[model samples]
Target: MSKVEIYDTTLRDGTQAENFNLQLEDKLKIAQKLDEIGVDYIEGGWPGSNPKDIHFFSRIKNYHFKKAQIVAFGSTHHPQKIPQTDPNLKTLIEAKTEVVTIFGKSWDLHVKDALRISLERNLEIISDSLAYLRSHVKKLFYDAEHFFDGFKDNPEYALATIKKAIEAGADCIIFCDTNGGTLPFELETIISQVKSKFPNISWGIHAHNDAGTAVANSLMAVHLGATQVQGTINGVGERCGNADLCSIIPALKLKMGIDCVTDEQLAKLTSVSRYITELLNIAHPPYLPYVGRSAFAHKGGVHVSAVKRNPQTYEHIPPQKVGNIRRILISELSGKSTILSKAKEWGIDLESEDPEVQKILQELKDLENQGFQFDVAEESFKLRIYKARGELKKHYFRLLTYRVHDYNTLDGRPIAEAEVWVEVKGRERHAISLGMGPVNALDRALRNALEEFYPRLKEMSLIDYRVRVLPETSGTEAKVRVLIESRDKECVWRTVGVSHDILEASLQALLDSIVYKLFLDERREKC
Candidate 1:
């Protein structure tokens, strides 16, 4: 087994992906996180490409990294310009990194068509630029631009480019499948030949996912003798995307017998993945490999039954290893496991031998056939189960009826207010409050009515709100689904409500949010 180095380029290549931008602070935070998690190298950014990265490397200069090296990424000295004269090269030097990676044309077509440079001239550019950097830094890496295609088209010239970089004292050689179209078997064969010719030199592999084979090709190259792997977290990059380090790291360390980081904190894999997503405010990849929400989940009745008998029956690996949990969801296809697991999740005890359990499962099936989704609105699902089991306790203030009145303004002012009437423990209570919208008015009115009883509600607030309007007709009347997101000191959750009346949808959504918060308080008190 070889000691495979993991290089993280999320700050660089990842930003190339549409909408994956990180502020200077975000980049620093992610860098610190990668360092904390024991990545071998954190490629800060392409200093030559933009000002943000240049500012980042300078800002992070004083920050300490215990386990990883910070690398500055850029391209080879412009066409034929002198290395020192090129601002691109100057920025790389100013990045304050011990390691720098520069790319040069590896494919013959890129040379003649893309770069429009003679093959021999491109070779000299790679050699002299690398040699210049070698004098400036102790570590230098050369990216063989379009290397795999270059290998297939003109094997001799591509090897010649590698030889130039090696002779120029490049510390590591990385073959970039810039187009991301290479196949696994082809990558293995090319990497084998590169190894045979350059037996004494260390090399890295950077594959993209255009063909959806970046991960496979990366692993194949590693098996064929490459010692270093480079990719981005969550597979963000230009075009199709770069290899996903989240998948590659575990496959190398846990599955392939090679270890990168010694931090048992590797168990926090999914947490780290989610941490990045939260900062980016992007939806977490549900189908992400190794640590996704669905990675260990079993949904179908047959699969759930088998998995319940033995987790290893369907799961490739234990969910806990990657900081994920097995979730058996309740749906039309759910079996008894759904009832038992969901019951366990809600702290409900339903004996397996109980005959009523079957009836409740059937009821769940029927409710699912209705427009109810239990996955996102877990509180609603729990309430149904409790009611079915004769365990539901009504709120101290159960809502009777509510009316929201909104016009341009009360008296030449833009104001909205709501009136609420509710029977709390059989006593009638009423309240009103002004708000930003009809939903806001309703929420405020309800909360003001219950503020004395459930004062803990004040601790939480609605952070975000989303509405999905579904159109049945091509024109006017469209039904809308409102998904409200609320968060307190602990965390945030989403609950959705749908109706043709937008205000009614908003009201239902607001109710879900309040009930969910109350349930959380109750559960925490019990625990």
Candidate 2:
């Protein structure tokens, strides 16, 4: 098989995604991770558009990479001027990277309407940009923006655009599905035609995911002889997203037997995918292919049984190949076999015939029937397992009573105060605190009461709180389920609680959060 280059544009195109902004340090960190995973090209960002990217290119020069080439991305020169005179081109040159990628208009409609220039002028822009960068950079890739749409609209003009870039010394002519409307079959046909026309030229593909076929289109193009594939780590980009390299890389290397990153580097794919999402502060798409949390999670009884006997029965590839583990989800739908499998995974030596397994299974059913979703609350599920096995320690602190008061202050702003009484290590402690809301006040007061006994609680804090109404059959008095995410220096864990009153539900979850933290502290000490 041909060697396919993995060009990652997470820093550039990915930041365009909503709520996916990253700091300069974050960009550097992601770049390092991508390099470690053996990405061939890392497109830092568009250099001239913003100060952040300009600073990134300047600072990144100090760091040396092992395998990946750091590529500066930018658009072709303005239609009104030569490449050298274009400010964007000048910024690309100033970036001083060995590899530079410049995208130019291929669609006649964009050239005629968006650029408001003739198709002839657009051709000049493409050639001039590639020729200018070719001398300044060791590798110059020309992105034929909207090449598929342009080819379908006017094949002659679209082919002319890439032909000019190749003739003018573009290292690789990358066909782009800028609008992401092209299907896989359409991309295959168009890519094959382009490959035939320029049989000797190196080709690449950059696909977007508007129609949800970016990954398919990209792989089809590669099968049709394109050598380079450009995408983001988790397919994060403007609109839907670019093709997900997390899926594409493994598909290429493991499934197709194509050489991109080495086996050692490929194993880091899941870690890289997760690390990028953490930096973006975005939740990982749990259902995403290959590396997603649910990708290898078996929930059904038959599926879990088959997976336990032979993972290949339900899984396409071994999860550990990409640093992900096979997961057997225990739920109301799970059987004793599933519980046994999950127990083995958790290092709990529970036999299939163990009465405790049946007990926990019944408890899981009853809790889930009450709106407790174990899938989202894994920490709570683990705690239940420990409790069922009679291995759970007693709570570090027990709440005696708590009072929350809410009233308008002199400034007419509502103020909430909480008085918490708790028994810690057989000693009663009392504390009062103020907060923006009743829940916050309760949390503060409870922490204050327990801090004397468990000083380590100072490092833990509630990072996220969510409440979901159960059934809501009773309009005003519906039971609410609260989920609280707590994080310390060590790790993040979520705990859940349910009650008719929202405040009470939140307090239950908050208490569980503190208890879990204390448990971890005790566990570490025991170890």
Candidate 3:
């Protein structure tokens, strides 16, 4: 098998995505993870772009990397300026990295329209940029921006642009599908042409996902002789996204029998994907290939049964190969077989014929009928089962009652005050609090009353609250379902509640959230 160099541009290109910005500390943390996962090159942001990027480059120099070379990214010299005098090129040298990657205009249209430079000047810019950086850095990679589009428009000029980089000592000439509109067949044909033209030149592919063929195009280029592949983690980038290294790396190794990351490093794919998503606070796509939560999840009764017997029956590859696991989701659509499968995974001693299993299944179905979705609220489902089987401990605090009052203040702003009465460990406690809304007031009052008894409750807080109406037919009177995501230092959990009134629905979810946190603590103590 041939080796493909993995160049990660998550910190550079990934930040261009909407709502995907990372702080300086976050970028440093990600760079460490990338190096630990054995990426060949980690492209930190351009040092000349902002003070943060400059600081990142300065700080990154202090750390020792294990396997990856930190590469600084920037554009080629300005059309009117010489290489030594170009600010962008000067910052590239000042970043003090062993490798530098710079992009140049490949499309003649971009030269004339975007840069407003003659075709001859663009070639000189590309050559001078690489030649200058070639002396300062151990290795240089030239990115031919929009190479695919350029080749389609003027193949002669595009080839000439890359030849100039090759002559100027670029270790790798990376042909980029900047617009990401090139089809796989077109990419394959173009890559084949380039390989034939320069048999001895080191080649790479940098693709985006606008056409949804970034992975296919990248692999096709490798098949045609590209030795390096550049992408962002989980495909985060401008527009559609860059090729997802999470999906592409595994495919290159397991599917195509090409080696990019080692077997040991490949095992960290799922964790790396999740770590990045978690840091960004983004909802990971459940259906994302390989590393998604639902990638190896079995939902259908027949599929679950077959998967239980042999995972290879329904799965293309073992979930563990990518550090992911098979999941058996329980829902109203599930059957007894699925329940038994999930129970077995949770270490519960149960069978399909158990009366307890039947009881739990019926309760789940009824709850689903009442607009409670267990698929997204598995923590609530587990708590329900534990309560039904008498394995759950008694409540730490029993709610006697709660009252909320809404009134206008002197300034005419609506204020909500809540009074909560709860019995904790045989004694009753009363607390009152005010909030901007009824839900917030109730949450504050409840926490105020309970915090004294269970001081650990101070650590638990609601991170997100979501509500959805059951049906549009009832309009404002429709039953609403509320899901609350709560997190403590150790873990995060989701709980659900439903009611006709919005406040009541939120209360139910809020109560469940607090109860689940205590329940988790109790289980930990028993263990």
Instruction: Summing lDDT over every window of 10 consecutive residues in candidate 3, give the lowest-scoring window.
Output: 518-527
- Candidate 2's residue-wise lDDT over 48-95, tens digit each? 899999999999999889999999999988888887689999999999
RMSD of every candidate to native, in Å, equals 3.2, 2.1, 2.2
Better of 1 and 2 by TM-score: 2
Clashes of each: 0, 0, 0
Q: Cα miss at 391, model 3 (Å)?
A: 3.2
Candidate 1 lDDT by residue in tens digits, 1-527: 67888898999988899878799999999998888667888999998888898899899898998988999998888885988788888998888799888888888888899889888888888887887788787688888989999999999998999999999998889999989999998998888888889899989999999999999988987887787899988888998899998898888877887777663656777888888988999988888998787787777878887887888889877887767888887677877777787787667898877766788778767755544455655556666677677765666457898888877854676668899987765677899999888888888899888877789989878877777666554444777767787878886766767777878878877787787778778767332
TM-score of each: 0.90, 0.94, 0.94
lDDT of 2: 0.88
Q: Which candidate is the best by lDDT?
A: 3
lDDT of each: 0.82, 0.88, 0.89
Q: Write the per-residue lDDT of candidate 3 for residues 230-340, one digit (tens) a residue.
A: 999999999999998988888888999877778888889889899998998988888889999999988888888888888899999888888898888878887888878
Q: TM-score order of candidates, best first? A: 2, 3, 1
Highest TM-score: which candidate? 2
lDDT comparison, 1 vs 3, better candidate: 3
Span of 10 residues, lowest total lDDT, candidate 2: 518-527
Q: What is the lDDT of residue 146 in candidate 3?
A: 99
